[model samples]
Target: MILIANSEAWPGFSKSIECLRRGERAVDALVAGICEVEREAKVRSVGYGGWPNMLGRMEFDAGVMDGATRQVGAVGAVPDTLPVAALAREVMRRLPHVMLTGDGARRFATELGFPIDETLHPDSKRVWWERLQKELSPEALAAFPDIPLAPLSHAITDPERVRDNTVFLGRDSAGDLASVTSTSGWAWKYPGRLGDSPIPGAGYYADSRFGAAACTHTGEMTMRCGTARTIVLALRLGHSLRQAVDLAVEELKDLRDGFIGGVVIHAIDADQTHRVVSLNCEEPIHYWFWQEGMNEPEKRAAERV
Candidate 1:
């Protein structure tokens, strides 16, 4: 099994993977572990203290994918819920629909016995109130000479970028894959805004018969370019994983808003040939591996482009 998650709280995610390898169920392990990390770090894009929406409300989104069967379940725009990860799992289990959103998502969560609360976290509330106070003060207007003060201006402008958490677990066999992605969207975004994180084939894609890949950061570019799918298609067309990622990044580079952030990919071939690629503005593409023969994971963080 292999796992890759993006968070400042890496230790917890790493520990969770270890526990899952021990005996815990995969879904349960992932949700519990991630939630625990979120609680501890108070990251403002996941559970509990996540960022609020434009309306000063908090809504979360998450998704899980089963590579074996190519199945996916997702929820968007939910508020004040634990196990937001579980909600994604439930979508994979109960609903025939691939995705749910807004009030509908909230209703479904409640129906499934997930509790809802008007208040999310004290930190989120405090941030919202503090921003409100700042906006209301006459000093704010005087401090900014050109920009005008308004509810929408301060509320929705420049929504905070939330880091997503992703995990991929599967055997070393040539054809086996599994993956998940969870996020809270952008902080202070529009009420119903949705990003690539919960969108199938955009934020993530996996297939045991084909390969697996999950992406994070720059959802807008990923969605427009169909980046995850593009990478997979590139590999299927005979490009190596490294070549595919480089090509994908190159394709997006010339576009107006292309490839603004980073992407992480894990791919394994039928022969158990595996590759991991981490691409970002500041770092050149690199690879890592934990193979059957290797006693520990080997990382090659630097390579000439």
Candidate 2:
């Protein structure tokens, strides 16, 4: 078995590894790790405590891909819910649809008895207010939730928020690979803005026969390029892991227009060989890695080209 996840997933990756050690299903193990990040108020990149949308709502996005089946389940722009990654897995198991969003997603969780997590960390809310107060005029602040936010969305930016998401990719003992992507998305984004986290073939793609790939942060670039699927296709077409990753980076570099930023890719081949690379990112990236026979996951720096 092999497992690799972005650094933000550190909080709960151990549980995921443990599940794999005990021979649990690959998707289950991936969810086990991501749920830990989702439920923590401190992670601030995904799940409960993450920064909210322009209106101060904790809207979440998450997705799961089962490599053996090529089936996907995802939720986007959901509000008042926790354990979003787990709910996405449930969408795969119970529903025929590949994705759900907004009120529909919330309703599905309710039908299955997922609890409403009314708790957005107080500090997160405070920080959001502080930023809003600085960006919006007193009249705009007074108008608050009643005002149109999409116009202001681009105006109020959180430089760090766009660069955060929890990405996990794993292959189990049975040769089944899986991936989970979870995030609160860009802070102060327009209401109902859905990034790449919930989109299959863009943010995440898995194929037990070929390989699995996941990307974080820059969803816009990946969405247009279908980056995760591109990496897997490159691997399936006989590209080496390094070559496939670089190809994806080259594609990103080709995009000379539109919103663009850094992206981190985590990938693993059918033989359990893994690679991580960052593109146009200001800082180095690190991720957790472990393969069969390893006692613990290693924290390694991602390659930058």
Output the lDDT of residue 102, model 1.
78
Those runs of model 2 whose alpha carbons end farther than 4 Å from true positions after fitting are none
Cα lDDT of model 2 by residue, 1-305, tens digit: 99999998989989999999999989999999899999887787888768888778889999999999999999999888888999999999999998999999999999999988884778878888888888888998898878777778678877465557899999998999998999998888888888889999999999999999999988989999999999999999999988988899899999999998899989998988899998888987899998889988899999887
lDDT of 1: 0.60
Quantify all predictions' global Cα lDDT against the true fold.
Answer: 0.60, 0.89
- Cα lDDT tens digits, model 1, 12-60, are 4555555456655444555555556445435555656566765677777
User: TM-score for all predictions?
Assistant: 0.76, 0.97
